[model samples]
Every structure is written in structure tokens, then in C-alpha cells.
Target: MQRIAVLTSGGDSPGMNAAIRAVVRKAIYHGLEVIGIKRGYSGFIEADMWPMDLSSVGDIIHRGGTILRTARSEEFKTSEGRKKAYLNVQRFGIQGLVVVGGDGSFRGAEIFNSEYNLPVIGVPGTIDNDITGTEYTIGFETATNTVLDAINKIRDTATSHERTFILEVMGRESGCIALMAGLAGGAESILIPELRYSIDEVCEKLIRGYKRGKLHSIIIVAEGAGRGLDIGKQISEKTGLETKVTILGHLQRGGSPTAFDRNLASRMGSKAVEALMEGYRKHMVGIVADKIVISPLDAAFKGKRTIDLEIYNLANILSI
Candidate 1:
């Protein structure tokens, strides 16, 4: 492959800039021309591309979000849109393509590889950490740390006012953020979409805690389990505790990438370019047991990554 292009798709995650930097530098190190495709598949269709060199990526490894930017392209889902993108790939002489995103982006990459036979590699870059084949995704560490920070601060007030605080973390279909953050934050209860959680059971726990003279508590709720407001309301009504809701919203997605995230992004990015050099395509990069590995690009589309039941069970036990 003489020239390769890379793009970030779907929601941007922390350490994406590091991945971009590594992709650009690694490809240049291997004597390959690198092109930065803005806004993912949309950029591919519209030819929103520019040559990237070492200078183009210098000093961005510590940054959050993607410097190349990202967007969820609706048009890219259609056959016609894909045809347009293939035309751009041909015109730009891009022999291999690197896509950095979650499962949705990999689905596109898989189809593109099948339909056009373009060499493609995927890098998991979601905070959800819900993609299969890898234990941790790019932004999960940073986002979890962000949630921990919020919980730590909220704990101060909860302790002072003898209140119960409900923190809502972002996770539509997965509970990874809530599970990890809840455990790390020492939350009393962690509610996630993956498991059945009854509000009555939660109220009983709170009631028991109160009877035990536990005056303050923290609950981490994944958005998918229930809205923070509704959860707070139900808990307050049932337990008669002063419950407050705090929605972290998009705050978890911002800020500088953590060292773990930066390192992971760098490793994954370089490995992606190396995979292309080794004639691997329609594949995704992953880290398992701290070692870089490769998997089918569309592995995530088969099913969302299953939560580690052991970890979840341990969290439940520790909470008790």
C-alpha cells in the first residue's frame, strides 16, 4: 500500500488524537503516504482529505476527542453513498484505510471491505468499552476516571447533608461505565441495562442502610437502566431519603486523555498500520491480556460485548 487514509467515525472518544498521531507517524515511518479523512465516511464520500505528515500530528497525543474530527454519517449507510466513497478512495490512490470508532463504524468498514475490496482496519475508540474481542476500548479509562471525579465531589456533599446522591453516567445499552465507576466510587448500588434491577429492591437496600445508621450513600445508574430523574424520584419516594440527581452528560467525553488511554491509542494506532503492512484487512485491532491482537472487523456487530459477569457479581458483593 503506497498511500493510506484514516478517519474517525461515530462519537469521538478520548485518546483518538493519540491514535491519529500514531497512525500518521507510524505510516510515515514505514514510507507510506498518510491522508487524514475528516468526518469519517462522509469525508470519504466528499473527498474531505489532506496529506498528513509528522508535523501534522505533533504534540496531539495528550489531547481528547479527534483532531481529524468525527461524525455519524447517515448517508454512508446506503449503497450509493458507499460508491461515492469508493470513487474518492480510487482518486486519492488510497490502498489501505484505517477507521477509528465503535461497532457502528466497524460495520461500515466491514461492508466496505466486502463490497469494494478495500483494505481496512478498525480501531475501537468508544468509552462504552462494550465492543467484543478487547477488554478495554480507547476512552473507557478516561471516562471512568471522569465519572470517579464527579462521584468523589458529590460524595463530599452527600456526606455533609446526609443525603443520597444518584449519578447518571452515559451508557445507552451497556453498563460498563456505571459498573466500573460505581465500584471505584464506592457506590452503594450500581444499576445497568445488562441486569434486571428493581427499584423496590434498591429502596429496600437504602431502607436497610438507613436502619443501619448509614446516613449518606451514592448510586451510579447507567442511563439505559433508567433516567437519573426517574430513578432519583422513585428512590426518594420509596425510601423517603433526600436524593439528588446529577447527570454527567457529555462531560465524561471531554478533557485530556489519560495516560492509559494515550498509551493504548498509540499502541493500537501503530499496530493498525502494521496490520495493513502485513496484508491484514477487514480486521480490527484489539488488546487482550495487555497484548495486541487482531479480530474480524465486524465481530462487534454480531453482538454487543457481554459484560464480565464475574466483575459485576463481585461489585455486587463488595457493595454489600
Candidate 2:
């Protein structure tokens, strides 16, 4: 392929800039021209793109969020919109494409490739880590660390006031963040959507901990499982204990990416360009067992990524 274009879609995630930098430098190293698509598929439809060089992505290896930016394009879901995108692809003489984002982004790439027969490679980049096939998505480790830090800080105050603190972390459809952070933070209880949990059970755990002379309690709740305010109120009513709620929200999505994330993004980003150049279309670059692996793009988003029940059980046992 003589030319390739790259874009970041879906929600912004840390280490995305690192991925972008890798794609540009790697493509240039291969003597191929690189185009940066702004605002994702919306940019494609509007032909909002520019040629990228080495300096175009300089000093962004540790930055969070995407340099190309991203946005949801309702129009891109329709055939007419995709046709417009394809027209731009032809206009630019693009030979292949690299998509950096999460499950939804991969799905879009898969469909676009099917219709246009364009070569496309995907690089997973979401904090949710909900994408299948890949053991871990790009921003997961950094986000988990962010949550762990917040939990540590919150625990200090919870102990000082001898109160219960319910922390709500990001995870609208997955519990990976809550489960990981809760386990690492030594939370007394963790409520996740994957496993049904009752307020009574949570309160009982808190009461048991207190009976054993525990001064404070920390509970991690995935936003998908329940709201912190609602769960906190229920626990307070049932246990007659002081309760406080802290929602980490988008705070988990920002900050300089951790070393693990930067390395992962760089590896995956370079692999994506290599995949396209190797004539592998509709495929995703993932890291498994500390090695880079490639899988069909559809495989990354075809099924749900399940929580590690073994780890969940261990967390429960250790917390008790």
C-alpha cells in the first residue's frame, strides 16, 4: 500500500496519542504516506484529513486522549454517509486504513471494509477493556491505577471518620475496573453488574466487618451495576452507619498514560500498520501473553468479555 489513513473513534482513552505517534512514525518508516482523520468517521464523511509526518506526532507518547480527536457520527450508520466516506477514501488515493478505538470502532471498520473492500486494521483503545479477543484493552491498566489511587485516598478519610465509603467507577456494561480496583484496594465489598448483588448482602458484610472491630469500610460499585448515591443510601438505612459516595466519573479517563499503556499502545499501533501492509484486512492487533497477536476484526467485538470470576471470588475471600 502506498498510502494509509488513521482515525480514533468512540470514547477518548489514555495512551491514544501514543498509538497515533506509533502509526505515523511506523508508516513513514515504511516509506508510506499517512493521513490523520479528524473526529473519526465524521471527518471521513466531511473529508477532514491531513497528511502526517514525523513532527506531526512529536512528544505525544505519554499524553492521554487522542490527537486526531473522536466523535459519534449518527450519519455514518447510514449507507449514504458511508458512501461519502468511501468517496473521500478514493479521493485521497488511500490504499489502507488504521482505526484506533474500542469495540464500536472496530465494528465500524469491519462494516466499511466489507462494503468497500478496503484494507483496515484495528487497534483496541478503550478504558472499559470490554472488547473481546484481547486480554486487555489499551487504557485499562492506567484507568485501574487511577481508580486504585482514588480508593487509597478515600480510605484514609473513611478510617478517620469511621464511616462507610461507596466509590462508583466507570463501567457501563463491564465490571473489570470495579473488580480490579476493589480487589487491589482491599474493599470490603464489590458490586458489579455481571454478578447480582443485594443491598442486604452489602450491609451484612459491612456489619460483619464492624463487629470484628474494623474502623472503616470501602465498597466499590461499577456504574453499570448501580449508582453510588443509591447504594450508599440503602446501606445507611439498613446498617444505621454513616455513608459517603464518591463517583470517579471521567477522572479515570484522563492523566498521563502509565508505562504499560504506552508500551501496549505503541506495539499495537505499529502492528496495525504492519497488518495492513501485509495484506491483512478486517483484522485487529492485540497483545496476548505478552506477545502481539492478530485476529479478525469482528472477533474483537462479536461477543461480550466476561469478568474473571476466579479473581472475584478471591477478592471476596480476602476482603472478609
Candidate 3:
């Protein structure tokens, strides 16, 4: 295709602007037009499109969030809504689409492709990193670093007060964020949705630590695992340990993109434009084992990948 349109959907991640820059600059380098679709699907429904030249994306590589902005629209999920989106595409002469967002965003892209025969490529850009098929999503590294920053601060306070802290990280369904952050942050207990914990067992461990005069225990919990507040209340009622809770909500999604994410976004964005030029469509560009690969959009939607049990097991060993 000679020209393609790109949009950011759902909640914005840190490196989305970098991805947009890559797509526009790379498409231009390849002699193709790249249009930035504003406010995600709404942009198409409302026909809010603009040409994204080199100047449009200047100095955005280090920026957080998205340049084109984002939104969630249920109309895009409907047949009539999709028809409207495609009509707008035809009005603008757009031949393909590059979507940067999470799983829901991908599903919308898939629908657009099926109904309109428009080539669509997905670039994973969510902080959740819960999307299947891709080993690493664009915002994950930055979010991890953000989580660690908070974890370290919490750790200092935890140590000072000799209290148990339950720190919750965001991940809607998958445990990748919690597992990696917990391990990296030296958390004493890591609770993820993938694992079921016995409250008695947890209390016993904390009681043992208390008997040994251990100061401050750090507990990392995935938001999907269980409510951190509920668990904290349980521990307080049962073990009578002074507990603190820190829920790192959208704060983790607002920082500047890290060097790693920026580089990855650049590579993935260029690769996406290349794939479209080569007639590869309706696929996701993902990094697995440091290699860029294309996965069918359908396969990605049908599958839900989970955390490696072996890594979850290691948390137990380290917590001891």
C-alpha cells in the first residue's frame, strides 16, 4: 500500500508517541503517506484525520502518552459503526491502518479489517503487557521501572516503621508485571492472579518473621490477583501486624518512555510499515526473543497466554 493511517486506542501508554513517530517517519522514508487518526476509532467515525509529516512528530521520541490522543468508542465495535469508519477511510484514500494499543484495540482493528478489507497492523503499546502473542509490549519496561521506583520508596518507609506493606501493581488479567516487579523489587510475598494463596500460610510466614524480629515485609500484589486492601485487612485482623497499602494506579503510565521502549518502538514501527509494503496485513508486529515477527490477528484474539509457572514458583523460594 502507498499510504496508511495510524491511531492510538484505549488508555495511552508511555511510548505511544514514539511508535507514532516511527510509523510516520518510516512510512515517509519508504515514500508512503502516513495519516495520524485522532482520538482512536472516533477519529475515523468523525473523520478527524491529518497528514503526519516529519515535522508533525518532531522531538516526540522521549515523550510519554500519544501525540494523536486516544479514546474508547463502542460504535467502532458495531457493524454500522465500522461501515462509517471505512467510509471515512475511503474518503481519505487510506489503504491500510496501524493500530497502537492493547487487546481491545486489536480486536477493533480485526473487525475493521474483516468488514472493510482494509489492511491492519497492531503494535502492542499497553502498560498492562497482558496482551498475548507479544513477549514485550511497548510500555512494559517503563512501567516496570516506575513500579520499582515506588517499590523502593515503599521499602524505605516499610523498613523505617517495621511494618508490612502491600504494594499493588496494575495488570488486568496477566501476572507478568507483578511477577517481574516482585522479583526485582525483592518483595517478601508476591501474589498474582495466576496463583491462589492460603491466608493461613501467609499469616504463618509473617508470624514466623515477626518471631524472628524481621523488620518490614514487602508484599507485591497484582491488581487482578485480589484486592490489596482486602488482603491487608485480613492480615491486620489475623496477624495483628501494622500494614500499609500503596496502589500505583495510572501514576505508572505517565512517565517519559525509557531508552529501551523508545528503541523498541522505533524498530517495531519501522517493521510495521515494511510489513504493509510487503503485503503482510491483519497481523501484529511483536518482539519474541529479540526478533520481530508477525502473528495473525485472529490467533492473537483467540489465545490468552499466562505467566510461566516456573517463575511463579521462584517467588516462593525467594520469599522464604
On TM-score, the candidate that comes out on top is 2
Of 2 and 3, the candidate ahead on lDDT is 2
Q: How many clashes show up in model 1?
A: 0
Model 1 regions more than 4 Å off: none
Model 1 Cα lDDT, one tens digit per residue, 147-238:
99999999999989999999999967899999999888889999999999889988888888888898788999999888999999999998
Q: Report lDDT (Cα) of residue 156, candidate 2.
A: 95
TM-score of each: 0.98, 0.99, 0.98
Q: Given candidate 1, what's the lDDT at residue 81? A: 97
Q: What are the runs in model 3 whose C-alpha is more than 4 Å off? A: none
For candidate 3, what is the total of clashing residue pairs? Answer: 0
TM-score rank order: 2, 1, 3
**Sort by lDDT, top down from the best:** 2, 1, 3
**How much does each candidate deviate from the true structure in C-alpha RMSD?**
0.9, 0.8, 1.0
Clashes of each: 0, 0, 0
lDDT of 2: 0.94
